[model samples]
Target: MDQMMETKKHNTNKGQKLNVQPLRTQTDIETAKFFLSKNKMGKRDLLLFLFGINTGLRASDIVVRKVGEFRNTKKPYIVEEKTHKRRKLNLSNLAEQIDEYIADKSDDDWLFPSYKDRSKHLTVNGVYRMFEVLGKQMGRDDLGTHTMRKTFGYHYYKRTHDIATLMEIFNHSSQQITKRYIGITEDEIDNSLDHFSIGI
Candidate 1:
């Protein structure tokens, strides 16, 4: 056990920073959801994954949320942990799922409680590890908690083509930042090159 621990510690220390990327394709997202649902994370993990992509809330906020916050509420409001901004979030699309998940549960229960200790919500590292494991399983080295929010931003922008609204949603300083965050910069580069044709 000690040898295994040492090896694990060494491996983790080798990679200080994780390069995480968003779930760009629908199939990848579905596969991840299906895999995690059957694994240790179970239903709660599925909810977290879905909620993250849907609401674009950071894992910190999601981890600390209680059942009461989501119970009997269509537009749940939360004060972001990092920014300390009170933002009204719309999660109506997942109303049925949220309702079913929170059914028969107490208002005080943590929405994503720790598996070992029921009283405490799951830690940020716990959530991050979940994504890391799933990312490895999915053959995506660039996958982590932030992927959820980035996925939401990428898909939302694709569907709406509205950078202004997305900018406001993310509270970004400028549309350029939003564009770069969602990887629109790469797309723009591709489009520009595609249009550049020298008339020979």
Candidate 2:
């Protein structure tokens, strides 16, 4: 059986929830990028990976994007599918790459077109399956569509240590939820306990 199926079996036997975690380390992130660049849909997969980690957009929103939305725009506007909130994406970090990726494409083309039908966008489940293979290659079972968004949150928080800003970015109600969502709380707990002693 495949790693994904095996992971499901293991979770079922252990009666534990299957949690999708972020790529917490830079090395792991680089590894993911390397592997994604070698996938069958190398360029598209790499662009999607960069887009997700950079924008923190959900898989649904990212998949539905059109080349026109980002073309010649430094701050592309979008209304999130899940939140229905309109916001502008700061594409300064991705402008050069996006320009190159979309240079040959028309404005109406889906940013992440389906392999079978270029007219249609790739599905969220398709993104999940792609990440599943990436996770298996990375020796991790806890990775899915949310991993990209969470990876963005994790690294951003580590750099800025600004939970309030991250909460706003995620549209989360509380800082605690944002911390836990990005595994920050869990990481802190693990780090604190790693050096704890009871005078034994």
Tens-digit lDDT track of model 2 for 37-141: 998888999999999999988888899999999887989899998689998899899899899999999999999999889999998778887887898899887
Superposed model 2: Cα runs more than 4 Å off: 1-17
lDDT of every predicted structure (CA atoms) = 0.81, 0.86
Please state the error at residue 20 of candidate 1 in Å: 1.9
Global lDDT for candidate 1? 0.81
Report how far off residue 117 is in candidate 1 (Å): 0.8
Q: Model 1: which ten-residue window has the lowest total lDDT?
A: 1-10
**Cα-based lDDT at residue 44, candidate 2:** 96
Backbone clash count, each prediction separately? 0, 0
RMSD of 1: 6.5
Q: How much is 114 displaced in model 1, in angstroms?
A: 0.9
lDDT of candidate model 2 versus the reference: 0.86
| Candidate No. with top TM-score | 2
